[model samples]
Target: MSSFRRHTCVAFTAAVLVIAHSAAPAMADDIPGKIAEASGILNDALDFSQPPVLPTIEAPRKTDIRASIDRGVAFLLADQNANGSWGSATRTKGLNIFAPVPGAHHAFRTATTSLCISALIELESGGLCQDVAAVAESIDKSEAWLTEHLPNLRRATSDAIYNVWGHGYSIQALVRMHGRHQADAAKQEQIVTLIKSQFDMLTRFESVDGGWGYYDFRYGGNQPTSSSISFVNGALLVAMAEARDIGVEPPKRVVDRAIAALRRQQKPDFSYLYGEYLQYQPMRGINRPGGSLGRTQCCNTALRYWGDLSITDNVAKNWLYRLYVRNGWLDIGRKRPIPHESWMQVAGYFYYFGHYYAALSMDQLPAADRAPYQSMLAKLMLDRQEADGSWWDYPLYDYHQPYGTGFALMTLKRCLPD
Candidate 1:
């Protein structure tokens, strides 16, 4: 059997007790103080003299990677919606990728829009874009839409899919924008204030355990375990880290606990479970040898980017090497129907997402370790770039391409050498 198909399946067996931290809970009364406290830690751990930049790691295929980013930027510039929000292609309806989903456009629209904005900022910062003015104009329109909509989104219903993701990407875009526009003192202050407000909004919706979840439970008093997914936390955690890097201090306890919550899910081998509470259930197919691979890259990349060196040193780096070097993420032999029921099969749906995270994770490794996977990842991405300069996980519609392209560009930026 191929290495991918030969993996053993592991399931959640029991609930492991999470060590209690008195300050872990998010209480409004103490959150402001905690936000102040986070500043101390942020100042000590990160350098905020300049905007957050992707690692200056060297890749053998730097030329091709740069080309790919330029193409991606072009596609995003060409694909912006007239209203300035990038909506997922609502036209593609089906039982699989498009199962008549509720709030699909609303959630993905903001999330993807912010995602692309962040991408453009990254490209511009890295000097990959040939036309700064055009990208800036695109960002201005998108930022306008996001700013006008922030109030409603901040108070969006608990069930809204946009809660964590939309807020997470919004924070990313705003933080990057803050850094990009630092030369303008007034605009910088204004952008930073907006960034802080979004972080404050996200903090309110954090799961009881400290992780930001995609769904809010406050409305109907629903349980958090059903919606506080790990990958969503992963995305938000990285965003929080970026916010901290750019000088927007979130509540220390909230960031600390979210990291802790994610830490609690890390297995001995360093693979993270899909949900914290799911750690006690069968996990049906989300476990190892099943669908664990689907969540590995995103979860681990979050930890790695957020400075979890223990995982980076011991697990994520090595695992990514194995996954890409062996093409294990492809899971070549497990092609079967009813993909939703099988973890191995469902991984196919997240192919591009996983690869994107994989690229991010690999980018953090030391040169020696990153060398082997560098060329491999470059080829994987360059070969897949569509002629129009966008990429997608599924071909359901062109909607996914912008986000996919954004992710691809981010990955390629990390692949660039010093």
Candidate 2:
């Protein structure tokens, strides 16, 4: 084993020992059966007997990718709150423990900061960002804040509709942190402990149907029904798969059951359901308008990251790319403003998030298939970057810009050649 891997194992063990008492284990006795069933169904979903061969084409990088990444990092550093998180107190005010709202700035800080950290880590990992020392400092402060605030942020509110996004992103960032610190055994171990503890926390909160829900399903009367969101499940699965790849093994049953939940909800056309019953309905047609398009980008990207090459290949050729081709991703409402399809009003809500995930999907594709999408995404993103090295989809009282910048930087990192 690599020295870092060994350190990570130790860190996980140490973290489990330290935090085991505080965490409550999930009701997982029956999960194994669910896993078995889901596995059987997923096996039938694909003809894995002949997996497609991914060609080894070299990824072509846009000349400005590195500069764009650095500017994004600078934007994040400039906007970071004194508390080390990236949120505004005014927007986060009016917090009632039970009645949390998605627009609340506090509601997004941990996740946003986590995303920034993940982006910075990716730049550092790929050696794409020029300011190495500055990047390290930015990551340290943001990571410290996240680690400290995670417990409080994990608390449930009455309107916890978008909590899963935070949890999913949090794990993704933590896993990246663990992987990037491999050269420093001590730092890697410290991050591994955080990763393990958070994974355990996440496992305890897995929805009743073997997936995660937008709400904290454990309490708040939020029970996972047939109407769960595929985006949440996909995000959790990608996080779990990445964690496992980095040698921090979550409970096998938890990972298996989550994968099973995804298989059960996946549509034959490669488009995932917005909800359990609302399969293909696009985010179950949640509050945001034109959300189906946004959800498609995130869910498919997550699926692609977890080894669904078919989704990536098809998306580049005949799927969502077609939508982007005809109707620019800039604003869907400009072309068609159906009641729920008001892209202008709501596309801003998930604009950066969607593009970030979509870029991730392209990053995993074989070079030949990845080039065109990479070029397209790079141009679209570069065109939208603000003069201050920041990006924002919706200016919702001071929270969206930094978070959006975080998402954009992460996406741009993928555009750079490894």
User: Highest lDDT, which number?
Assistant: 1
Off by over 4 Å in 1: 1-60, 96-104, 154-157, 215-219, 222-227, 281-284, 305-309, 326-349, 367-369, 395-398
Backbone N/Cα/C clashes per model: 2, 4
Query: How much does candidate 2 score in TM-score?
Result: 0.72
The TM-scores of all predictions, comma-separated, are 0.75, 0.72
| RMSD values, in order shown | 13.2, 15.7
lDDT of each residue in 290-317, candidate 2, tens digit only: 3345556667666666666656464533
lDDT of 1 by residue, 234-281 (tens): 778778778888778877887777878877776655556766656775
lDDT of 2 at 340: 28
